[model samples]
Target: MHAVLLLMMMVFAAVMTGCSSGPDYKIDIIKELYYQKDKPSPFEIKVTEAGKAVTGLTVTADLSMATMNHGTVKVKFAEGKDGTYAADVKVPMNGKFEAAFLLKKDGEKTEKVIEINVVKPEGVAKINGQWITDKDVSFYKFINQLQLEINRDAARKNYSGKQLEEELAYLDSQEKVLDDQNKLLTQIIRLRSMALLAEEKGHKVEAAEVDAAVEKARGQYAQFASAQALIQHYGEEKFWDVEKQQYKLIVLAQKVQKDLVDQAKKENPKAGDQEIYYQAQKQYEDLLISQINSLKIEIL
Candidate 1:
């Protein structure tokens, strides 16, 4: 009986020691989970102990909600770089979620529970993780349609009756083309891509330049009553604010164009100004294509 008692005590002590082992890990949500409509949300978490990454562990998760009858979502995480594990988890809806994670390494297992929030991105597309929001696309459409109306109003002076009807009809069709979302997105992408390259090339647009460009645009629009009415409808302050941002980027893009024009002139001193400008324009287009291809663009 004494020998058996001593062996039991030893086993209990061993169990206590195993339970008291160090380096307990904790899992943290990387970001508020962004849920997709057509597929599983890309869920990510980081595992750390003593503020250091805990790696080489197998992590599996069960996602559930306390208020819902929906079955739990079983997730098998795949490790990414720097102690991050990701799983494409499909949840019933966007809201609070409890993630029960089981992390195993070297026969040692740790369980942790983290509360997560899932939401949807506000944008229809993304470039390098920067969202081009739906409202932004809507504003572009509005601007395009407004410009068409301005042209139609100007054509009223030169044409009348049937001729005026044809001109207005053509302008209306142009508005329809402008309403294409992809076409507007393409325009935005082209402008942003060129502006990005201009910044990389160390081009800077001063506030004075943006102001001058805005004034130039304002003066051009001032000639048409329809332009004034549209600007008033859009709210002059808001319209000018948006125009200032666009013109700032345009100023940057102009600098990029000027750089190409200068390079063309230097490369072909004998070429006339017209030929040089044509070559520069082609080079600018090629450069824009290359830059766009390098960007991380995603259209949802």
Candidate 2:
């Protein structure tokens, strides 16, 4: 066990001797095991041999608590792109844990042990190394549904029979897929990046500002019965709790937008509101790209 811990700490050096292999397999951690209770926590790793990726190797892990006596759980890895392999490991709880990885190819068998600290997932991904929590994902899903439900209600009222079915089908077609999920994650990243830039520019998101923004949204949605029903379904207090956090960032971004709009207006004194807004939006996108490039982003 002490030998295992030592090899785990070495990270890139854990290896085994095999007649058919070159330079001993180098195992690297791609993603760590995260705590998900009895649910599967994703663990990813990359395998290399002789300075090149080695594919078609079978891999598995025996997971066990490091500090306490918890029975070992076994998980098998499925091959992924390149030399990457991933496994969904189920653990008894979140804490210090260790995994003993067994890799096999041809007649060669290699074992690599690694220490993994299992904690609650910070986020589905990271922005400048900050975790994007499950809460963020849920809120995005909810807010998107708010508009969809409203449209659904509108279709029910204005269309009937086959026409209604077609409208409903169109709405269903809009349901989120992998691309939409990526888009939402990108949006979350963009908003956060802009908000951080706003703070750097000395814009403050006060509680009053957040409250006002949220209230404005509430008032706008209040006209739609479907919106109200959705809010009720999530519990109004719970809905607003997440919403307020979202609006705080939003308000900060809005401040940045307002600054850009002000700049556009000054430059185009004769421009109408729409023209000014369009200019500001273009500037905002350009600035967002610069910010994203300058920052370190990681998708976990």
Q: Which candidate is the best by TM-score?
A: 1
* lDDT (Cα) of model 2: 0.84
User: In model 2, which regions exceed 4 Å deviation?
Assistant: 1-120, 154-167, 178-180
- The TM-score, computed over Cα atoms with residue i paired to residue i, of candidate 1 is 0.64
Colliding residue pairs in candidate 1? none
Candidate 2 residue pairs in clash (backbone atoms < 3 Å) = 123-132
lDDT of 1 by residue, 1-300 (tens): 999999999999999878753458878876346667667656678889989998898999888875676679899999987898987777777777788888899888777777777678777777777788887797788778778878887889889999899998888778667769999999888888899999999899999999999999999899888888988998999989888988988999999999999999999999999999999999999999999999977665
Please write out the lDDT profile of model 2 over residues 1-300, one tens digit for every residue. Answer: 999988786764544222334337888877777776557767788999887998999998898999899899898999998899987777888898778878988866777787878887777787766888777877787788888888898899899999999999989887754236677788789999999999999999778888889889999889789899989999999998888988888998989999999999999999999999999999999999999998867564
Q: Local error of candidate 1 at 23, Å?
A: 27
What is the lDDT for 291 in model 1? 96
Off by over 4 Å in 1: 1-33, 36-69, 72-91, 95-117, 158-165
